[model samples]
Target: MQYIRNFCIIAHIDHGKSTLADRLLERTQTIHSRDRKNQLLDDMELERERGITIKSHAIQMEYKYKGVSYILNLIDTPGHVDFSYEVSRSIYACEGALLVVDAVKSIQAQTVSNLFLAIDRNLTIIPILNKIDLPVANKEKVTYEIMYLIGCTSEEVIYSSAKEGRGIDKILEAIICKIHPPKGNLKAPLQALIFDSFYNTFRGVEAYFKVINGQIRKGDKIKFMSSGKMYTAEEIGNLRLKHISKSIIRSGDVGYIISGIKDTLSIKVGDSFTSVNRPAKAIIAGFKKVNPMVFAGLYPEKTEDYDNLRVSIEKLHLNDASLTFFPESSIFLGSGFRCGFLGMLHLEIIQERLEREYGISVITTIPNVSYKVFLKCSPTDIFLVDNPSDMPDIFNIERLEEPYIKASIITQVNYVGAIMSLCIKKRGMIKNQYYLMPQRVELIFEMPLSEIIFNFYDRLKTISKGYASFDYSPLDYRFSDIVLVKILINHQLVDALSTLEHRSNAFYIGKKMCKKLQKIIPRQQFDISIQATIENKIIARETIKAVRKDVTAKCYGGDISRKRKLLLKQKKGKKKCSLLVK
Candidate 1:
């Protein structure tokens, strides 16, 4: 245990965390040079295409320095805020972290967020400045920023170019010297913390855990602290980019246990595991339950694929504990499931996986944040609504509270004015602002989660010329004057088009929605009216004119009485059609 080192890499998206991990693996010869690939830790194709890590991966490595053999366990984590919960779990399982920052772009929002998480866990941090080989790299400025953020001296920071495999040996030496090994009691009863898990067809649920006390071996009976169910360990192994069987995983070691349990729900991330026969007196302190922040309804494009969609979602949830879903039905879109996600990126990734991996195309409604509604008659009577279609009648509600978030944006100085203006339009209240350096600034705001769910990120990228990065955390719900805006097509309500917006911007939002709908809905035999309404009042209206055919053109040489009679018949038919629409 004294020669074992457990550490994880944390940084912002596109900051080269995976590249650094690959270099370390190469330096340690854990993976052969002939089988090298870009972003080896990011196994998913979507992750490579998007240039970001989605899932956390752990690998065990053997390194020899100064004729001393050591065991190094490294975990590579996602850098996006949507997967911060996953990063937190990875951090809790490690003894230290490597803080990677870009030499050109300096520190980003997620970089700061991850640093805070590492500090909160009381883990040792090793700061590394990457991408120093770039032509535009600003090493001095970036080193200063890292020093300011982490309170470290210039000599303490390591410089490297991960793409070119520079300074990898120095990083390995630092890890061996700086990072402390895991320490636990070997005489106590068995206790382990399950950080992650995935399903396997051949064996069952494979649980990735760190032994906190005692030891685990094959044929040992273990019980989950939360589920209170017992299962025999079919296998015990360590990860070397692949599962390698081991006879025993002693205390202060990380390994996987193949418990002969078919149900994936029985094994949860952040659950504790202990010996069934000689149980530990107390379970290890695990992380809090993960709660999804964004909600949306996913419907199959074809009704016959409903069962396929359900199966696909179940398979997805087995690997991802942050995702939640339940059965939901819509009058316009048919039967579907109401799904919850960590954020917008999580929702997009799930949708893409369902289509690509499961071969099931789906239609997704507008995404929304959960809202708390209080009844007028009883102040204590409160309920949560995840879908606008399930919202209560407008007349029965007393007050509405929506979720808010504390957002941090880091960008160049020139784009500060534009970002501030955009935040004001989105009803964001500025909380603080300071200069990270003379050329860069950090702006903090408290805004509604619903406001940024649709187009805030895209607009921020556009206005900032793709140099700005953002991170946010959920704040408590606050009472606001919010209303549900409904869209009507020829006097019939379309529940899929409904949205919740602040009362002050109802007119502007409604007008824009009506104009957009007018262009999408096709013309019919009768004039179709698109109306945006709040309660009983219509705020915006657009009319799609009926298809006009010249009936009088065919009767050019006819009598005047004949033409008049034909025109009278057409007018009567038009009046009847209009009455039917009303």
Candidate 2:
């Protein structure tokens, strides 16, 4: 245990985090020559195509220091703000973290966000300035920024290029000397904390855990403390680049375990594993429940395939525990699942995986945030609503509250005005602003999660020319005046197109939605009356003209009386259609 070190690498997106992990693997020869590839830990197809890490990956390495063999467990974490939950889980499992910053870009929003998480856990911090070999690299400036953020001295910061594999040996030596190893009792009742897990077809669920107290061995009866389900350990081993099975995993070491548990919902992440023969008295603490920020509906393209979609999502949820979903139905889209996600990117990734990986054709509705409604009949009881169609009647409602967020944005000083304008347009209120550097500034805002869940990120990047970085944390819900906007086609309500928006912007958005639908909806035999309504009052309307058939076109040579008769017949048909619309 004294010779073992566990650490994780964290930074902002595209800030050389994955590159640093690649370099470390090469330095320790933990990965083989044939297996060496770019972003090695990001094994998913979507991750490679998008050039991002959506999940955290763990691997074990053996390093020799001063003729003594030392075991190192390294977890590579994602840098995006939407996946910060992954960073938090990884931080709790490790003893130290390498704070990687790009020499060219310096410290951004996510960099500061992840640093706080590691500090809150009291983990050892090793600051490294990466991308130093680039021609545009500003090594001294980035080093000063890291020192300011971490309160570390100049000599404490390491300058290196991850792409070029410089300063790898120094990083290893620092880990051995600076970071402490795991401390546990090998003779105590076995208590292992499961940090990550994924489903497999043949072997069942493969869970990666860290033994805290006693040893866990192959064929030992293991049970999850939360679920109280027991199973014999089919396999146990260290998590190298490849699976290396062993008979036993001792205390204070990281390893993987495979039991015959086939049910996807049976194994929950953060659950503790204990020996059935000598069970632990209590479960582990410090595991936080996930709080989703955005809510959306996912319906199958065909209603008959709903069961298949549910199964696919169940299997996928085992891999991504952050995703939460519940059954929901809409008059417009039929049966579907109302899903909650950390952010828009997380939602998009899940949608793509359902189509590409699971072969489930899906229809995604507009994303919204959860709300709390207090009714007149039950003022004390809070009614939670995520879908707009689920909102209570206007006369039955008492008070409404919507989720808000404390957003922190980092960008150049010149684009501050543009950013502030964009946020304000989305009903964001400015909170605090400060200068991180002479040219770089950080702005804080209090805004609705619903406002930013759609296009705030895209608009912010466009306004700042991709120089701005945004990160946010949930703030308590506040009093909000919002209305439900419902869309109707030919007097029939389309629940899928309904939305909840602030009363101030309700009319504008309603009109905009009507106009947008006019262009997309195809014309029919009768005129399509697209109307946006609020509380049974029509606020905006658009008309799509029907394709009329000229009944007298072939009667050009006929008598005047016959032509008049045809015209009168067509007029009567128009009146009948109008009466039916009413």
Candidate 3:
């Protein structure tokens, strides 16, 4: 019998997936007793600093219980909305999931969304109610609430405090007893599902996968199902706790393979691998290509650092596949790459890494959304518009459907009226409201994605006084008034800085972006006007005052040669204009 166990931990952001993984690593003795570093699963610097798992990390451990040595593969997946697609891929790699619900917070929108994904994948789910050791301990009530939402029996719920190391053994014991092992042909043709990949300075590309069938050994030739590219595996290995070790990953084993494939483009996160000797047909259903909802152009502040920017992006792609980039030149920014990302946090992470790791200073354009537009007299059109210069020429786009999200707010009942008013101001339509308890209520709203792009988060905090927790997921796009808002530098429409926004929220966003850009750009030689144009008509404008120190006080010539050199220096200063686009 194949004694393999595969499972993923699903939870809301900050609900302790990483912490639970740390406990699991400790209980399994993956790390030595002396190792004191916490959150061992989140090894990345960015992941540790952000206190969230950016990518799904896997670790394998061998545990002996009841005289049987069991192999357990634990996949720590992302909990944020930006990586929801990756979360799904992680789910596919496992036969069961351990849904970690915050004992105090109960069920959240992401928790519900992840549970639905697990159900859709037909994975056996074991819901664990965490945070019992806190002062507000209501494990029984939390268990009741989870069972009510998930339709599970009260007995199926497991309560624990992952932080204090309480009930961890029960969690592990439940995995062994309740979760089922893989049911596939172990000795058949090799077919491994590559869920995640990372780059090592010494090891090239490390592709982590779950072997469904057939045996994979060192020095075997393999092919990626999606890329159709062949590569020779230098070594096939499995994670012994956190370290990758050389081992024969047979059927029903969750492991990683190191191949000579150095280029990240050849190995995609959701790609499948098959043996050259016995190639199996690829199943493309599990991997859904993540479309970047937000777009931004990253420009090197120093023109000479363009190559460094490219190198940084290339390195970033080694681990982050959701980020897409294309060579783009702007009238104001000149040569740069327009990058698309899952959301604001994803964009910030990439930008911070580019500056910190690559040692390049960059100026990024305000992010905009991709829209689907339908002309009044022509066929449907789908394209991206970041700057106003890219707007369609004189074409009457009667209607457009921008994306919106179904947002849920869980707060004290006292704050419901305030949150409801805030939602209304953001053009949100209330769908449902329910009381989890007498004091806590869940407020559901369908809100346009544009409304939450900037300071909506800050606004929420201000209104709720940090008492409200929010979660949201993408809803279907609906028809709305689409306006093309273009940002202009010195009254000239900059094609690289335009955005397609809903008519209802265009002025607010346009004004907001102008403020951000104004704060970054230095005062110019002349008063620079920042304008927002809609359909070639200027709707908003902001003035940046001229720099007072642009001109230098002259000094009398000491020598004939010195006088000529001073004139030349003055001419060069005139060429270095402060206005970005004049």
TM-score leader: 2
lDDT of 2 at 433: 95
lDDT values, one for every candidate: 0.90, 0.90, 0.79
TM-score-wise, the better of 2 and 3 is 2
User: TM-score for all predictions?
Assistant: 0.94, 0.96, 0.88
Model 1 spans > 4 angstroms off: 549-556, 560-582
For model 2, what is the error of residue 357's alpha carbon versus the real structure, in angstroms, after optimal superposition? Answer: 1.0
Better of 1 and 2 by TM-score: 2
Best of the two (2, 3) by lDDT = 2
CA RMSD (A), model 1? 2.2
For residues 448-524, write the lDDT of model 2, one tens digit per residue.
88899877899999999999999999999899998999999889888998999999988998999999999999976
The superposed Cα distance between candidate 2 and the true structure at residue 567, in angstroms, equals 4.9
Which residue pairs does candidate 2 place in steric collision? none
Candidate 1: tens digits of C-alpha lDDT, residues 502-570: 899888888999999899988866789999999879999999998776778889685798878887888
Which lDDT value does model 1 have at 80?
87
Writing each residue's lDDT as its tens digit, candidate 3 over 1-582 gives 257889999988888888888898888888898875777877778888888888878888777778898989988988877777668878988889999988776776677778888998889899898888888867877787788777899888888888989888888888888889887786678888887777777878888888887878888888888778999888877877555766577877887788866675677777788889888875545566777777888999988889878877876776777888988888778899988887888888788877776688898987876666666776565554544445566466656777888988878888888889988998899999998767778889998887777677678868888767777777877777877778888766677677777787788878887887888788755567788877777777788876555222454536677656766775556456643334
Q: Residue 284 in candidate 1 has what lDDT? A: 78
Name the TM-score of candidate 1. 0.94
